[model samples]
Target chain A: MKKHNYSAGPCILPQEVFDKSAQAILNFNDSGLSILEISHRSKDFVAVMDEARSLALELLGLEDKGYKALFLAGGASLEFLMVPYNLMKEGGKAAYLDSGTWASGAIKEAKFFGETVVVASSKEENYNNIPKGYSVPADADYFHCTSNNTIFGTQMKEFPSLDMPIVCDMSSDIFSRVLDFSKFDIIYAGAQKNMGPAGTTLVIVKEEILGKSGRIIPSILDYEKHIKAESMYNTPAVFPVYASLLTLQWLKKLGGVAAVEKLNNAKAELLYNEIDRNPLFKGAAAVEDRSNMNATFLLNDAAHTETFDTMWKAAGISGIPGHRSVGGYRASMYNAMPIESVQVLVDVMKALEKAI
Target chain B: MKKHNYSAGPCILPQEVFDKSAQAILNFNDSGLSILEISHRSKDFVAVMDEARSLALELLGLEDKGYKALFLAGGASLEFLMVPYNLMKEGGKAAYLDSGTWASGAIKEAKFFGETVVVASSKEENYNNIPKGYSVPADADYFHCTSNNTIFGTQMKEFPSLDMPIVCDMSSDIFSRVLDFSKFDIIYAGAQKNMGPAGTTLVIVKEEILGKSGRIIPSILDYEKHIKAESMYNTPAVFPVYASLLTLQWLKKLGGVAAVEKLNNAKAELLYNEIDRNPLFKGAAAVEDRSNMNATFLLNDAAHTETFDTMWKAAGISGIPGHRSVGGYRASMYNAMPIESVQVLVDVMKALEKAI
Candidate 1:
């Protein structure tokens, strides 16, 4: 049975990506060498690295705009430390919006560098919605925010324009929707969600914002050194980067982020509309702030829980269990998740209402 | 014809690992979903992480000892920074041995944290030998060294008995030979040579050595935190870790490290003997310090280079060109490299001598 996999991260990629990447593992580019066995500096892999970097920028429509896309090891969690190490000057202050677990994690690491101010936090509300009407300090080195909260199922619809560099953690929502990517100086995403797999992170930084930190950054943590070395300062996550490239190529063939955004919007609407119309279920996040990629919802009454769960399982629907912090179900619809999967979940919900 | 691959790091792995990992990408463990599409927290993947970690310690004979094995991202280069971060106290000193380019790189990173002392250096000799008779500063936080110098084709035959904690970067020679694994506090290797691929790093650290630095380490760079998280502090390098587990299983099926050590010794002897007997070729490193994993050699006369290069290429040999700094040929025979490939290279060397 083909599962309608909705696992939050390290989730579904295009079927073509799985097929092509698997082939590369066996015989990469007809070289008769497994991609796993080739040197990172080989012409074939260098081409892979180059193309992945450029294609990332091209999809975001940030080409030749003083931006360098780097496919680095250590997922977005490591970026929490590197962001502060690269952007926070000695005794610098960084302002962060604590919207969810990951956003708070980044703020914790930032506090190690210098004064870290939480501009606003939805934590008191269990991060049920994006905090609003917050202001970043004018003198802070940079203002950081998470575009989407995977755990809370909330996404910021608007970003505040600030004089200082604006950094966004787009780990779960990058390449899913079309946004003005240039509005932020630094945009990063873990490849696990919508991009590729779990090993690599994509960091898109405007070159001008780097080298001003004044702190003595270690070479591995230094963004300037990585850019100077063209993202090969160390052996990159070779297989992940190649898999990401195949995913990006798949996205491009389907008309880039713009086309995918349309598909994603339709999927979100189909699921959200059902959640709203059904008397037994209610959305977990604020309707206005709900994420397009992940829809969190719960039964209005606990009586229907077992039947609903059994129905979804019988329908071959998997990975809809919500995070422990937010109890219920979370149907994650990344770019590769077709609307047909969302409909299956909706049908299960409808079946529950009828069977009851 | 199957090409004999000798690329340094990101080199060859067992044929079975390639096939099995590729199959996993399509439908892992008969789970109906692609491995690339499954959650890392899933039961199947958590099982992989547990098995990979335990099998690593089991093969190293470190199980039941106070050691923990972690599969991490950022490769061995990241370990260069992480080691100092988690071990060195603030305002402390570290002792290092300058054996090769990678060792020098580690030394550079350690300097960023505190005073780094070079206990001994073979750099003046172009890293063609490992220095001996050097004493580490007892008061230093830890003593760091590289067990194998991949670029210069030298391996340490003995390590000094020191009171301080000992750390070794075993990126090239790990799993290829038997060593006193418990003597070191921390052992890190990029999973490219004698392991699996390039996306993940294998770190074996003695549990007692952690959290003693008294420095506020970032969670990502904190080995203690990673150990506590069971090596899943964040999403791990899932595919690479799985492939490494497959390779480790392969090694065990062939009778573990001791058995592979015998094979490695035979391969190294087969090539080193030919390099010594062939009038046209000479070994690069000191005979006493020659590496069993990577055997670097030079043509006695540069005039025979063209013919020798042609002979090797015609014999289906690839990735033998050496580092630009050395300007010769480096045949890297990691654990997965069969002795048959070494024989083919030896035949090519003989044919080159005959043609010349």
Candidate 2:
């Protein structure tokens, strides 16, 4: 069976990226040293760090725009704590928009450091749509939002340009689409989806947004310190950063973010169209807010569930089961997910409907 | 030239461990999936996590001793903060022995959470010797110490048997020797040194010592939470843990820590004897406290520096340069370092002496 992976991270990466990364692990850049064994400070690995940081900026088209990129360990979960620790000061409020589970998680951590205000939330609707018309308070230090909800399959179509700094968690759909990167004061993502692997996280912060928090942040949580250390504050998540660098290089070779978004849209459209037409399935999120990255849906009739699952499994599909909270199906069509895989899924759904 | 990797951390590993790890990164356990692409929640990676955590306890001789082992992201640097975050309480003092750089770093973070008392320190001697006859206060909530100093080449030959909890930073020389597993309440090591590679840290904690701090620890920093979640509290440093698992398996196959320790001591003795015997070289640390893992030394005559350096470089030595705080040389002979490599380094020293 031809494998079609749709796991929600440590997710899909370009096959070329995986091949190159595997080679590097064996003998990094012909250094005759396993990438696993080399010093993080060595010239070979340092070049990897430099390239990963610079290429991240280059792909976001944020280079020379007062933004610095960093590769750090601890993933987006750590970033939840760090964003508030570095940006939200004592006695100050940070506004948040809670659309789904990850957004609520961010809010929970931010409250530990300072005052957190949820201006709007879609949770009352089970987070099936993005929160609308949220007002950012002028006195708030920063406004936090999750750009995409991985489990609920809802993506923010337009970011709010607020008077305060805007921090966004773009973990699942980071490079899958084009975005106006300049609007974000800070952007962070775990490298498991649309980037590379799981160990490292990418943090891009605009310089001016730092140093105003007036709280004593730990060195590990301090963004300025990491930026000053060139992301070598401690021995970094080396392999993941190197793998992400390769993916960034692949993104550049495929004509950068704009080019990749086109294919992503085509893939999402193909799958969603099949879901709507077949009557056997229905889309989970609001049609306008449906993620082009993760397409969440469900079998219209519960009786078809086992049959459809068996069909997809026989066709070599994996990780299509939705999060327990959502209780349906989520086909994550990340950047590395080719249109053919979407076609395979769409064809399976059609076949199931025709047989019924 | 053949490579001789002697980096202080991210140092060296058994060739078979590296070979097996490299294969897993390409196709983990023949799952036909790159370890990089697989979901950590999958059965394949879950087995990896289970094996790594279990083998860590087995190698430490702490299995079934109520100690829980966890693999986490961030190196020992993060452990510096986590140790205090989980164990130290408000208005209580934690006694510490400041042996070297990492111990001081651990002290710095501990102070943030509680009153820290430095019971002893070797800073007066430029950290070249481990402090002796230090009293661990009974009233202190815990006693913290660094077991080995990578930069200074000092190792604690014996630990203080105290009434309170004992936390050790064994980042430099973990598993290179045997010890009474029940003596300490907590042991943490970065994977880069004697274990495997950079990125992940191994944390072994006694179950009873946790949840006493009364501080609201973040989920990422809370040891109890990680233990309860079986180190799946967050996505782990997958590749590093996988690599470390292979190294641990290699250790067990080589008859475990007792066997590896013998080889480690022989390698260290080979290099230290050369440092003492060669007219141009001298060992740095006090003889009794010198580390078996990192053997720090200096050139007696500065003028011979270039000649000696050239000799070692020509003989395929790498990363033997001493840390800036203690300059000259540091030949880190970790568990995986073969006695032949030490012989090669010793031969280089003798060749330099003959040429002079």
Candidate 3:
């Protein structure tokens, strides 16, 4: 069966990246050293690092500016704490926009460090919509937001224009769209989603935000520490970062972020359109705030859950089960997700509707 | 020219693991979904998590004891802070045996969290030997030690047989020898050295040692938090851990740690013997402390450095350059090094000796 992956995160990567990355791991750039074992300091490996950093800057339009692109070892979960450690000071505050599980997690991490005033929260609406009309804290260190909620299938169409720095966890929808890089101070993502692989976390941070925290941050958790060390504070997850770099190169060759966003939009539209028209399936999140990355829906009758799962699995659709938090069905449409995969998922929905 | 991989860390992997790992990243475990893209919660991936944990236990001879193995996202460098965070309490002093660079790093991190007493240090001797006659603190929270020094080839042949919780940073020497699990409260290592890859850090901690620390650790850095959550406190570095699991399975199939150790010893013996015999090369570390993993050596004549590097590189010998800290040459004969590779280095040294 040609399995279509809809599993949320540690998610899919471009096929080209996989092929190239694997080849490198076996024999890195024909150096006869497997990339998995090469020294990060070697000329060949350093080139990989340099190119990865360059590609990140190119993707985000930060290549010319002084923005620093770093590939960190820990996943975004580690970043949740690292962010507050770098930015928030004693009695220092940050405004948070809570939309879903991940957003709440970031907020939870921040409270331990200092004050985090939630500027907007969509929990009142069960996280089916983005909260609006809350004022960004002028005195806050920065405004933190999750760009896309992986489980809830809701997204921020535009970042709030804030005078304070902007820290966005774009883990789910990073490469899914085109955006101006100037609006944000820090943009981070786990590579498993819309990048290349798991293990490495991508941090695009403006240099000005760091060194503000009076607390002595541990070397690994400090962005300025990594930035100064060129992300070689200790050995990084080399293979994953290399894989991510390859994926970035592929993304650039396919016309950078602009082309990726268009394909993502097309894929999401096909599935969401089917859900909107079908009587058996109902789109869960608000229409305007609905993610073009993850499409979540519920069956009209709850008994159809098993049937839906069985049908999808047999049809070679994998990872379509909704998160336990929002239980029904969710088809995550990441960048590596093909239009054909989404089409098959849509076809399965149609087949189910006819049978019902 | 076939590149001889001598680049340390992210250096080389068994070719078989590389091929399969790459294919899975494209489409995991024949699941037709990219391994990078799968949900860490899925049954297929959960098995990977479980198998890796079990195999780690088996490799360390720790299965019967209630030892919990976890695949953490942060590299060993982060474990520097995490160790003290999970074990140290206010006014609780830990006895630390500083062997080399990494041991010093661990000590630095420990100081931030609690009082850390340097029981003994070989820094006075340029870290060429593991300190002797050191007393392990019975009242101390834990006795921290680094098992192997990568840059400086040295190892702790026999740990102090003290009735104290032994916490070891086995980053470079894990799986290089068979360990008696009962002695240590925790054994942690970065995967790049003797394991599968670089991103994932393996941690094996006794169930009882956790929750003893009074400090409120950040969730991601807490061992107890990870154990309770079954190492799923956050999404792990799935692909790297999965690859490491496959390598573990390979290691077990090749007769577990006991079997691999013989091979490791033979490789070390061949190189150390050659260094001792050759007038051109002199071993750097103390005879008692020489590492069976990374072999540090210096040429008697500094001018012959280029000649040696050229000879080795031409013969496809790699990663023989000494680290910057000890600038001569280092031949890291890790777990994956074929004995033939070491034999070739011996032959090269012999040829150079005859010409001189």
Candidate 4:
């Protein structure tokens, strides 16, 4: 049975991308070498780096704009440190909107390099909705925000436009919709979610925003150095980058983000509608702020929990368990997740409601 | 034709390991999901992390000997900065042995954290030999060295026994031989040579050596934090770590490092003997300090270069081109390289001599 992958990250990739990446691992470009063992500097791998970088910008409609895309190792956790290490200067302050766990993580790391002001937070409500009506300080170096809360299942429908540089952590929802790309000076995503695998993080930074922090950044942590080296400043996570490139190609062939967003909306609507109509389940997040990518819900009566869990397991569904803090269910419908999988989950919910 | 792999890093891996890894990428442990898309926190991947960590220590004969092994991102280059960040104190100095490019790189990063003393170096002699009889300072925080010079083909036959902590960059020669595993306070190697792939780096550190620097260490660069996190401090490079786990299992099944050493020695001897006898070729490094992993050599007559290059290419041997700085050929005979492949290279050398 084809299991529906709804894991928050290292989640579903396009089937074709997975197939091509598997073939590459066996024999990369017929070089008789596994992609795992090929040098990052090799021509085949270099082409992968080039294509992945360009496709990211192209998909965001930021191609030929000032944005430069980079594929790097260490995931978003590393980016949490690097973003501040490279951008937040000594004695400077940055504004952060803490929507959920990842937002708090970024805020903690940024505090290590400089003063961080929580412009707004939904923490008071257990992050069940996106914060609003927070004022961005004019003196702040940059405004940082998480576009989607993977744990709370809340996503900002629109970013707050500000004159200062805007840095967004789009880790869980980058390619799932179309966003105004030029508004943010920096955008980063952990590849495991919507991009590729877990090893490489995708960073798209405007070149002008770097080196303004006046801190003596370590070369490895320096964003400018990575861009100068074309993301091969060190031996890149070659296989992950190659897999990400294949995924970007798949995204492009699926008519880029615009086409994928239509399917994503439909998938979310199917499950959200089921949760609304079925008496056994209730939605976890506010209806206005709920994430189209991650849908969180729980059994309305609590007695049907075991029955619903077993049904979903038998239905060949995986990773629908909500974050421990929420204690319900979270189905992360990334761009690669087909609508059929969402239908499966909705059908399970409807059947459980009828049977219970 | 089945080509022989000899590329330095991201070089070669066991055929069975490749097969198994490729299968995992398709459907990991019958979970009906690609390993490329599986969550890093999943039981399957966690098991891989556990097994790989234990196997590394077991193969090195350091199991339960106060050494903790961790898999991290960014390769050895990241370690160059992290080692000093986590180990060297604000007012202290560390001694470094500048054997080759990587060692020099480490020395440079260490200098950024604190004062560095070059206790020993062979840079004047083009790093063709490992320095001996250089005194390590008793007051230095730690003594750092590179066990193998991939570019110049020099290998330290024995480590300098000292009371101070010993940190080693064993990127090229790790797992190719058996060494006194307890002697070093820290051992780090990029998983490209003799291990698995390019994205993940293996770090084995003595627990007692951490948290002594007193400087504020970034969580990502903190070795103690990574060890506590069991190398999943963040989303690790999932595919590379999985591939590395497979390679480590392959090493353990092949009688561990002790058994692999015998074959490694044999392969080195076969190629070194051929280089000595062939008038067309001359070894680059000092015979006493030559690496069993990388054999650097040049044609005795530069005029025979095209002929020798053609002969090796025709023999289906790859990755023999030496570092541009060395301007010769480097046949890196890593652990996964079969003796039959080395014999083929030897036969090509002999054929070139005959034809010349």
TM-score each candidate. 0.99, 0.99, 0.97, 0.98
Per-residue accuracy of model 3 over B179-278 as CA lDDT, tens digit each: 6766888999888877888889999999888888788778778898899998888878887899899889888888988998999999999999999989
Model 4 pairs whose backbones collide? none
What tens-digit string does per-residue lDDT give for candidate 4 at B104-158?
A: 9898878777889999889999999999999988999999999999999999999
Docking class of 3: medium
**Tens digit of lDDT per residue, candidate 1, span B81-159?**
9999999999999999999999999999999999999999999999999999998888999999999999999999998
Error of 4 at B268 (Å): 0.7
lDDT of 2 by residue, B213-317 (tens): 888888778888898899998888777788888889989999999998888888888888888888888999999999999999999989999988888888888
Listed in order, the DockQ scores are 0.88, 0.69, 0.69, 0.76
Answer with 1 or 2, whichever has the higher lDDT: 1
Q: On a 0 to 100 scale, what is the lDDT of residue B19 in model 1?
A: 93
Stronger candidate by lDDT (2 vs 3) = 2
Give the Cα error of residue A3 in candidate 3, in Å: 2.9
Docking class of 1: high
Model 1, position B84, has a per-residue lDDT of: 95
Ten residues in sequence with the least summed lDDT for candidate 4 chain A: A32-41
State how far residue B2 of model 3 sits from its true place (Å): 7.0
Clashing pairs in 2: none
Candidate 4: docking tier: medium
Give lDDT: candidate 2, residue A286. Answer: 97
